[model samples]
Target: MQDQNSAVTLADAFNQATYIIGGHGSRKVKVLQEALEQVDGETFSDHYGNGSIIDEFQQEMAEVLGKEAAVFFPSGTMAQQIALRIWCDRADVKRVAYHPLAHLEIHEEDGLKELHHIESILLGEANRLITLEDVKSMKQEVACLLLELPQREIGGQLPAYEELESISAYCREHGIKLHLDGARLFEITPYYEKTPAEICRLFDSVYISFYKGIGGIAGAILAGDSDMMQESRVWKRRHGGDLIGLYPYILSSRYYYNERIGKMGRYYEQAKELASLFNACHGIRTIPERPVSNMFHVHFALAASEVEPLLVHMAQEYSTAITSYLNKTGGNSCSFEMSTGDRYDLVPQDKLRDALTWLDGEMKKKRF
Candidate 1:
């Protein structure tokens, strides 16, 4: 059997093939033109963080989120950590509540604790969505509560809007600030049947990534009241997040925002159709069984050892890539995630199904 590193290399190979959307792979020249064309007169932000494309994008995001103001950061990690620190400072509690699977909890390497001296009170089960009851049960004094819309780590699961409303109310009554880790905020709007402004009204602060679903190179926006945003700019500078010129990231995000924001509803609908196709096949299962957003997980009842070659072989044979990577989940099972977008919409459904059917056939042949 090949080593774990080899499996990652095989995954990289599939990315080079024609795929129906996994990453933000449109033509390189097209992406460049889209970004450059957006540049009108000025292309740079002022010395600290003001005046050009950066200010324009921040204003646009704040309007979309219905917040008093917004600030852009180099990354969601910096944006979220700074947000939590601000809340914790205001309340003087230094403790926050969130799911164990939140990106801040799992991916940030304890930056909150190490840098800001803030503590996290983990809420809910690792595999399930957090509920109102989970917050009610927290015994400690938490300065804030952080919730990820369409929770990323556990197959993009989302709580009912009613439940979310209840949680929001609960936080307000308890004097706990509510913050949204809304990296995929745009992707969940279709399910809520609400505008982004309407949804964001429930939280004290909201942070959205420019790169994930929006397909920008990199950057994040943190939106809140004027005071909070003003403070965030200070934090952005202290953390060295204030770049001299954020034109490229800003322009790309704006370009994709105009082009793809309206297409998210279509992407969500297509994802549901694709999920139904996968559920019908043997030896394959989709998490949550139905996708609540543009993204979902697919599990295969085969080892990475057995599946990587098939992925490579299928890409070569069909001149198309079905998926870019599959991570080892447990004993013999492997899992990968999919987020639907323009490239996915391009492929004919029958051809997409044929690819999955072929994968199922290969896995079934190994059973006997």
Candidate 2:
């Protein structure tokens, strides 16, 4: 157990440590400032979602996703909710379906239901990816079906491409709109050995986050057919997502997306490598065993309370922070998420090896 009187929390320790292995790196203000340092703000005029910077970024993302058009939103939540609502409105059915653990179902505080009055049909068990069978078995008619690639909550697991194709065909045959919650779409491409457009061609609509694997300041692109995107623009404005100037988010998104998008394969490989190291440690295992993307869940055989002190000690002593917190999964087990990024490349291999060795020895002492 951590000392009650200790001044440093696990998060503080992780943040203060010399080496941190997680997404991008410190999300300090300077990260955004540095990304904008090369830009001349005076040379570009800010316009409300209609001008060069925003319009070009939206067009670039639409081409990348193989959609006819794309609309930018301040957040993925807004973009996604609007996308689903648009589909539902088009189908004349106020119902949608998605995984039970989907961000819409779990994270959005029922905004889809309350704001749009759209009923959500959960398609599968919370612990697993929504299989094609799950979609085929749905008894209810839905306006749209939302599929998240590399399902984020479940350690970034993804369905096989064939299964995705089957699901897409089924939805199309039934006149059901298919929307992709592809916040991490770019991260999964290397795993599937496909391009962004190839994977996105499977869905009627797609939403990509500039902040997740792309390491942007914050923004999202919602792309689909020209008509749907025009409708979404109206919806985006209705949702107050259209600000006078989103250049900070837009420019930062473009800058970092270009910088890191090409490195997703490297991040995916690093995630698998890191997961293997965790699996090698006693009482620790990674979800999926092999990562399908640059993210995975780390499960500990000990309670979160027990794990926190150990992680704090590792960060303080080894100066290598794995994670800052753990979520209790059950009586004796806890878990935390690990997303590989630029920081993982910075960690000394020997230091990481030694830290894991120390962790393994400690876990053995605890018999966990």
Identify the leading candidate in terms of lDDT.
2
- Compose the digit string of candidate 2's lDDT tens values, residues 59-175: 899999999999889999999999998888888989999999999988899999999999999989999999888988989999999999989898999988999999999999989
What overall lDDT, based on C-alpha atoms, would model 1 receive against the true structure? Answer: 0.84
Candidate 1 lDDT at 208 equals 94
TM-scores for every candidate against the unseen true structure: 0.93, 0.97
lDDT of each: 0.84, 0.90
Candidate 2 lDDT score relative to the true structure? 0.90
* Alpha carbon deviation, residue 115, candidate 2 (Å): 0.7
Model 1 stretches astray by more than 4 angstroms:
1-9, 26-33, 41-45
lDDT of 1 by residue, 216-334 (tens): 77788999999999999889989988888766677777888887899888889978888887788777888868998988998888888778887776665555576767789987889
RMSD of 2: 1.5
